[model samples]
Target: MKATTVQNTFDDITLWNKMREGDEKSFSILFKRYYDDLVSYGNSLSPDKEKVQDCVQDVFIDVWNYKEKVQSAVVVKAYLLSSVRKRIARLYQRDHIFRKSTSIDAVSFHMEFSVEHELIDDDYATKQKVLHLNNLLNNLPARQKEALYLRYHQGLAVEQIAEMLDINYQSASNLVYRALITLRKEWKGALSLITLLSSGSF
Candidate 1:
């Protein structure tokens, strides 16, 4: 397998195991590989270019800072995606309400799956799933949708979602739970479609 192949499946047990052993090269490779993709993921959640960029940058820094303590990644892509999501959520809570003017809010995101690997043989299936998931997400209730986006897409915690939304932990949990349940219901006919598209399996 190629070097980039390690980044594809969360099940690629060897690469993560190497990174756990204080492997600088391993981590650097991972960071460089995912950087652009994470930025795009962040952009999809909010229209703020600076915040999205900052969010993706912070994710790499945080991962490096915690590398020693990090355990087996629960889907490395999911973990990275969630980290960027939470960072953006924090930026939102800190500035959204009080800011009179900001460039972050003016940014627009086109939810198109950017194909990083031109060589990756099957991309259409993946892109289709991403688009399908984006549409499903757009159908959720605003609060619930934001919470879910911040939590999973941005990889925020319950407390962070609460802080971002100005709600309590329980309320945030409820929103996330409700949102997942709604998606589960809404995605009834599209199970295969979703599994094919996301870094996350449906």
Candidate 2:
């Protein structure tokens, strides 16, 4: 079988194990699978597109170099997300953009939500609603916004989010929970907005 064919047949953990044994095909597959996601997540954490892209590349390079020492990941997506986040944070500190005392929490996270007009019959109303919903999301504290993005946008569980954010489980859960509550309280179309989130339309 072709290397690509064989690589496609295996799951992330299996491919990770293969890469550990010096399988370049497996490493390439993993990098392709998560590159866009890692870039998007990294961009949310840092506004510098060039820096984000560089950090993402650095992450994959590190993974490939240390494949032999890296353990099999139970959740590869979460692992990569955490890795890129830490990479961005370190780069910011090294550039003196962030204080020595700064951590991931000190890094600003920005998320924007878009609603498709086709999802709703009334284009004008949809635009108005989307604007309001976006305002509410932008007003949320940075941590809350990040939590919501990880939970809803990335489909990460609270536990995975906790590990990525380096926060306690309850804190992660509360961040998501409170974010939803605030949105629900402020928006009359909370259900529709939530539907858009759950459906991954935003």
Candidate 3:
């Protein structure tokens, strides 16, 4: 899992509570859990990796400084993600005028997946199929791809995705629905092709 959502699931309630109670260890754990994800998400908005890193660090700093005042979060991970986005945008506004402005709402999302080890066997054909599917997934529109990733990978519900993306509930549902429709349309044929290739029917 490259730059994956580090939490096994969004059940960060315990971690959040600990962090709020002045537990540095728990805070570190939470920061590690979301650090890579925040960097990746920040990269989606701007090419400046350094700026993204600064913003991510700043967000955690703020977390520490104001932890006592923090309220309980049903989805702590979503809150962190939103903070990263908003922080990056604000930094962009304060620092410089980018040709492509860094607006969280206008983030151009992209996802990258790791090919499984089975697909990395000595079989060259299987590798190609995996690569093809990888390409297809990478090509999905930012929002649609984000919807699918949150739904399938992070195990987040549509409501959580809506809040993270700052979109309406129906919009999030439709976005995910459309992505599934697109993937389902190609899924069978892609699987069949992989099967046929695996069987050496090429």
Candidate 4:
């Protein structure tokens, strides 16, 4: 892992220890830190903010209750996301949310670039063409786009994404591969053009 990743892991470990030791302040700090991220992810699963909030609240409450018994997570954020997704899935099952919407009403979402800043720099022409590239990305089928977003934007492992998306390891791995194949096939020429232009070779 990179230094930042190692640091974050250590921080989470410290926070987990504090929370386990009955430190109310640490509990509040942890809650405040991840609440917005949880809310955003919840809203993504369903646009109903009220329902999302309820699910997030419930997940946290459960977390607090089970904090003593909960195994120390390797990636705390991914574990939280997985919990939120499972909670929402259960809600959908109870409310029959899928039955309410036909296939035609399916919502399309692009990745929100949660980890985008680390990959961007002023010098990269690719940054300038993001809007166009995202448009091209929209051409991909929904599941393919989702898999790509989870892999690249969210920085999730295949196992974590598979658990969150409720798919098998092989399916998640293949999904990323297929999405990359399509993206590279479509975007290769554009990237080469940018490179050539930047080099004043045109």
TM-score of every model? 0.50, 0.86, 0.75, 0.70
lDDT of 1 at 20: 75
What is residue 6's positional error in candidate 4, in angstroms? 17
Tens-digit lDDT string for candidate 1 (62-177): 77778777778455665676566667756766776687443332323345332123323455775564456556666666666556555655566787666555568999899988
Kindly list the per-residue Cα lDDT of model 4 for residues 1-202, writing each as its tens digit. 7644533554666777677677666666667667887787677667689998999889878878878877766577777777887787677666766576322113334333321323444646656555445555666676666666666545688998787677799998998887667655645433442332222200
TM-score of 2: 0.86
Tens-digit lDDT track of model 2 for 1-202? 8766865788989888888899998889999889999999898888899989999999999999998888876688888999999998887778775546667766778756565545555557656876787777878898998888888878899999999889899999999999999888756653466676665443
Better of 3 and 4 by TM-score: 3
Q: Which regions of candidate 4 fall more than 4 Å away from where they truly are?
A: 1-10, 97-129, 189-202
Considering only N, C-alpha and C atoms within 3 Å, which residue pairs clash in candidate 1?
A: 48-104, 82-154, 82-155, 85-154, 86-154
- Point out the higher-scoring one by lDDT: 1 or 2: 2
Can you write out model 3's per-residue Cα lDDT over 31-129, one digit (the tens) per residue?
888898778777766688898899899999998999999887668877787788788767766665756665657666654544453535566776665
Q: Judged by TM-score, which candidate is best?
A: 2
Ranking by TM-score: 2, 3, 4, 1
Question: Of the pair 1 and 4, which is ahead by lDDT?
Answer: 4
Q: List the residue pairs that clash in candidate 4.
A: none
> Which predicted model would earn the best lDDT?
2
